[model samples]
Target: MDLSDTQHRLLAYLREHIARHGYPPSQMEIARAFGFRQNRSARHHLEVLAQAGLIELATGRARGIRLTGPGTAGTPGDGLLQVPLLGRVAAGQPIGSDPEVRRELTLDPSLFRLRPDYLLEVEGDSMILDAILPGDLIGVHRTPQARHGQTVVARIEGELTVKRLDTGGAEGNGGHLRLLPRNPAYAPIEIDARIVDFAIEGLFAGLVRPG
Candidate 1:
């Protein structure tokens, strides 16, 4: 299905907006961007695009727009991956878990050394020395097991954290497993499997720093 000029511009705006902010623009924002008098106009155009298979829309969510076309941000056949942007994870300390899918991101597989199943927003500066800073989206390769000295997304008592894994036991330490922070100010998070419910969520593949 061929798109009208106005539809093409609107689709471009949606792509640029998602590329810049990691999410789609709201209906009001779209209406304003395209000089529409009402958000209904924006919705109408979006529905047209959806019918063309260029995008997908979810009901009742402010940022529910998703690009799924070939050679676009989402979908395959153009060397891209539609990686889901899961909720935030702590880089300093384990924070409350929120694994909800905020949105899907169109990313190049070459960006990460290892392809990631999903992306997690970093929330703290604990991993600064390793170049994983706050607000950076870290790629996570989903795995139940990670090797020693690998950076991992770990879960402790239901909370999530990003840190380097240390399985070698330290003398007199409570347990052989611990999560190490790159910054010197923070101490190692020693994991005692006997007491704390611990699990390796995934290995850190790479990262994307938002501009």
Candidate 2:
């Protein structure tokens, strides 16, 4: 139960995947989820988790990973809800309505300023200045609208990405709204509603960092 941060995440992901889809992710899927280039990386992690009593891997089966029911910690309570952990939101499109739920996170709604509809495992450092890191979990409140300057999950063209909402271009830039990144290392993304598909997926509600 004394899991490393990565191991803890793996366990959480295993539980979440099963909860959402009634199946655990394959080793390859886990590797891909965590950005590991090789299946061996995930295999090693799974072995570690198994030895720790967090999961049981059935031999000879493809998707045989099973949760052993709260090993390192006690059972979760009613105060927690399993929030879907979404995969990468590409910059060119909105995420599909049935986009795969990579995992589920058990969280308390009261921990955040607003209740979150889901949790997104961010993949890039575009929002580093805002303390949103590559592996950090950002809680999202499902909504189609956001106030100017608020952080939001949006889809442009067909891809999805997170950025600060900027609705100030009613006259200039051909009324093209912009998705601004907090870090100066990245430039703002301009969205011309006339030329590309665009929609707001959610508003930033809270954040959970990996420990």
Candidate 3:
């Protein structure tokens, strides 16, 4: 879908801020920066994009928007809300893998406000810079968009991993995804549908630390 120039630019800026800051830019910031005659102008653009199936809103926060791009996925399980806790992810060079994971955990839906379709354990360091450790378990919200830069569990290039989203722009063509890490030692990884299917498993809403 083609975005209006305004939408395109606004989305790009938000994406950039998310990459650098870890959240969406506030409507007030958008208003002051864009100098719209009214804050509603900036808000209208977001509403347009959300209606276009490119984003979502969180209801009460200033920057409560989420982009429904490729950061969502799911699997069924048992619970009051039927939240699924995935065993682990096989995000390596291998393609089309049926991971040997055998157990799906059940979690309380109220904790997340989202009854996730599945849960996966974080397994690498590409995202260590983001304060996510190797054994920290991540909860995915089963959504397509990661709200620009919200941390997400994504399937990239035949592997499932977690990272922040940095996508968009005039160059926002097909299969162009940028996976950024919080730690400077690590570099960002980008892939597309052809090389790697961008499936957003869900937001890493929370984690468990066994003391």
Best by lDDT: 1
Task: Estimate the TM-score of every prediction.
Answer: 0.71, 0.58, 0.48
Which stretches of candidate 1 lie above 4 Å from their native place?
A: 74-87, 99-121, 136-139, 169-175, 192-196, 205-211
- Best-to-worst ranking by lDDT: 1, 2, 3
Worst 10 contiguous positions by lDDT, candidate 2? 71-80
lDDT of 2 by residue, 104-143 (tens): 6555444467788887767777887877777777788998
Measured with C-alpha atoms, the lDDT of residue 86 in candidate 2 is 68
lDDT of 1 at 178: 83
Ranked by lDDT, the better of candidates 2 and 3 is 2
How many backbone clashes are present in model 2? Answer: 8
Best candidate (score: TM-score): 1
Candidate 3 residue-wise lDDT, 1-211, digit = tens: 6788888888777655644433457788888777888889989988888887766766676667655544211122322232344566433221242345444333334345454566565565666555566665555677766666777777764567667777644133355767677667666776674455567656777654322
Task: Show model 3 residue runs off by greater than 4 Å.
Answer: 1-83, 90-101, 104-106, 110-113, 170-175, 192-196
Q: Where does model 2 exceed 4 Å of error?
A: 1-78, 90-98, 169-174
Error of 1 at 143 (Å): 2.4
lDDT of 3: 0.59
Tell me the lDDT of model 3 at 86. 51
